[model samples]
Target: MTGSPAIPEASAASALVFVGPMAAGKTSIGRRVARELGWEFHDTDARIVAGHGPITEIFAEHGEAHFRALEEEAVRSALTGGAGRIVSLGGGAVLSSATRQLLRGFPVVLLTTTQEAVLSRTNLDKRPLLKDDPEAWGRIYAERLPLYREVADQTWASERRPKEHIAAEITAWFRANHAPAEPIHGEAKDEQHD
Candidate 1:
């Protein structure tokens, strides 16, 4: 991590969008938050793998551009349809300007942590960007930091903590701001931030 100033938390959006580097706890946190809110949970990476095939194979056969195209479609579909759901995007999903634009009215949470924190969580063999290199991970994280910040309505550190606690914080925010009419939207009242 560079010595940049910490990003301030923003407010409000139609749905919750989680963005960050690989192994950043997006899927786990998103799932817990969605379950807490009784809404659906969608992970764009999972969708891509399900609909197309292995992402590595896609990159091998076609290219990164083609895989990103597929990602765009999956992200778009989830955004347009997810009114009360939590969405977890692939680490690089925000690289596209159009995707960033689409995220404007959505509650984006940038889940970030130091490389040391993610070392245990990371699956080196699977991520093309990291290529199992710690330095490569840092470089890519530095490159994507600005893009992640651009769309994030909130930012949270998931290092050495329970994902449920993080999910609870996000759930509190979503409930405070949106207050969805449905019974399953939770019963919290106060708005708190850390």
Candidate 2:
């Protein structure tokens, strides 16, 4: 109940990719899930930062198009990197067709939040697209909902749940629906819970 339940050794090799709108808690939930499963955790945004530069700087210097191109490349690296890991993607990571194609073989979970929740959790200035028109963030989110749905293998709304509860739900879903493959790097040991 506190963490992921024991996964049997026979489960298939698989990876969980978390996607959602800004402030939907992908990174937080992903970290929790990865910890519980004893799997590696990677964030495409973080990879983007390591590979290129800070996202804000990328957007400011080159522009949205350039930033998105980098995002696509980062996503590809994360997806093909192999199983037994949780990958958290940026809010707008789904906007690229190539990224969606790369995710085809991975189990994608969409973490969703209400528009009001999104507005409350994030400031418009930090997000390049919303800096000039804050209210437009909601509109953009509404437009992208369908796109997110189109690519999601499963959807979990994180608006009301605690992070552990959300992680538990995802863990349960993975257990019942799929098996974990041998860890691409090494076997992941189950974590000890309090």
Candidate 3:
């Protein structure tokens, strides 16, 4: 965020966040969108690895809750800082109540893909929750859909199309939905989370 877009002066709290199921191209889209807007791109999962150890190691030694706590703090720091940045959150990041509440004010874009579409791209070895089975992927997607919907400000399907196209569409959506010159601000407690 050293060199920024000419939009306006605002705190790093105004970052655009991407949330969705694993392998839904959240990282790819976030990076493209950030580049499109001349902003920095960050991935929460990568941050977790950098701050802590490997995620599976954390899950093995500490447990999911401990890993989740780390995720919560990472999400908080990412949001509280980095105004001209786009963040791709881990699939389970929104599971934290604090993360969900913190997401209330930001533009949380939910990217979705059909099970068939992601099959070729998703690496089961990397995603422990996938359990090396497509059924498990489906089940997890089903379980997280409601929570994703609850926090999403907008939704887009990341089908078999190119990543750049999806990113361009998101950029257009923001241009149409968000005020051109206004800075994205934190939500007032009196206002609705949407």
Q: Write the per-residue lDDT of candidate 3 for residues 135-191, one digit (tens) a residue.
A: 687788888899999999999898778999999999878767653365543322111
Across 1-194, the per-residue lDDT of candidate 1 in tens digits comes to 12322222232244678999888899889988878876778788888888888888888899999998899888877776635667789999988876777677677889998888776667776887666465677788999999999998789998877999999998998788765455445332211111
In model 1, what lDDT does residue 87 have?
A: 78
Model 1 TM-score is 0.84
Candidate 1: RMSD over Cα atoms?
8.6
In order, candidate lDDTs are 0.77, 0.77, 0.76
TM-score of each: 0.84, 0.84, 0.83
RMSD of each: 8.6, 8.2, 8.9
Task: For residue 16, give model 1's deviation from the true position in Å.
Answer: 1.1
Q: Is candidate 2 or candidate 3 better by TM-score?
A: 2
What lDDT is obtained when candidate 2 is compared to the true structure? 0.77
